[model samples]
Target: MRVVIAGGHGKIALLLARSLTSAGDEVAALIRNPEHAADVRAAGAEPILFDVENTATDRLLAVVTGSDAVVFAAGAGQGSGVARKYTVDSGGSVRLAEAAEQVGTQRFLQISTMGAGQPPARGSDKVWAAYIDAKTQAENDLRARNLNWTILRPGRLIDTAGTGLVTLAPPPVGRGDVPRADVAAVLTALLPAAHTFGMTVELVSGSTPISQAIAQLSD
Candidate 1:
């Protein structure tokens, strides 16, 4: 399958690209920085330079054209401010979904925060408030699109190695941490899962094997 990933230079995106490529799938990474081309290439993905934050939706058509799926994995980065959250995370996500629909791409995947649907209370912090609001708004917008969408809301993301296991389900759980590589693994595992469509899965580190966990997903 041909997959297009926004924010292809991101850690998770890069890991996902490698996994997809290793599985013999055609992978394309959409990135804003040309300097990151080599890094994306090293991961065995074709890199497409595009700026979803500033570019028109039409400008993204070529990237998603004929692709099997579109993954909205872009973010404003760690040190970015509140405004950037709305632009890159919120606006970029909505635009990716819009572009996917416009290009007739049927599958859309989104990487979201664990508590976005019900963000934590951060009193008086405009930046945190904006971030949560952006994620919440983006998720809502994606749900309204005419596509097979799967939203993975992961717990605190860590840089530890993957355990090849995870706890995937609907909400009502407390906080926890999940390795970035594990998240990427789950993302790859769900790539062709029709059962994951229309599902917003909550993920965290656990003892269940990836395959076993994904197998329990309800249609």
Candidate 2:
């Protein structure tokens, strides 16, 4: 399969790209920085210099045209202010979904934050409120589209090695942390499964096998 990742330079995206390449699949890593090209290529994928925050939808379609699927791993990054939260997260995701639909890309996967749908307490940090607003809006936009979309909301992300185990469930769960590698593992495992279509999954590190945890989500 040929897959395009929006935030190809991100830790999880790089892990996913390497995993796909190791599985003998083609990967197109969409990166905004030209300097990240070598790093993406080192991850066993070709890097396409494209900025989701500034690129037009038509241009994005051109980049993703002929790809088997797309993954929205792009983010405004940690410590970014409110305006960018909308521009790069919510706005970026909606634009990609629109471009994906126009280009006939059938599958799109979203990497979202866990507290998105359920925003933090009122008068919380304005930036965080905006972040949740962006993420929630992005999720809503995907659900409104006529596309095969899966949203994965992972808790606080850590850089530890994957344990190959996790807790996968629906929303309103206790907060926790999961290794970025395990999140990538879950994303890969769900790609080929039909049941995951239109599903919003919540994930955190745990003891269940990745496959088993995914199946349990369906049950």
Q: Output the lDDT of residue 205, model 1.
A: 96
Pairs in clash, predicted candidate 2:
none
What digit string (tens of lDDT, one per residue) describes model 2 on residues 74-96?
99998899999999899989998
Could you tell me how far off, in angstroms, the CA of residue 62 lies in candidate 2 after the best superposition? Answer: 0.8
Model 1, C-alpha of 120: deviation from truth (Å): 3.6
Please give, for residues 25-48, the per-residue lDDT of candidate 1 as tens digits.
Answer: 999899999999999999999988
Model 2, stretches more than 4 Å misplaced? none
Which RMSD values do the candidates have, in order?
1.2, 1.0
By TM-score, the best candidate is 2
The TM-score measured for candidate 2 stands at: 0.97
In terms of lDDT, the best-performing candidate is 2
Residue 163 C-alpha lDDT in model 1: 97
Question: What is the model-wide C-alpha lDDT for candidate 1?
Answer: 0.90
- Those runs of model 1 whose alpha carbons end farther than 4 Å from true positions after fitting are 122-124
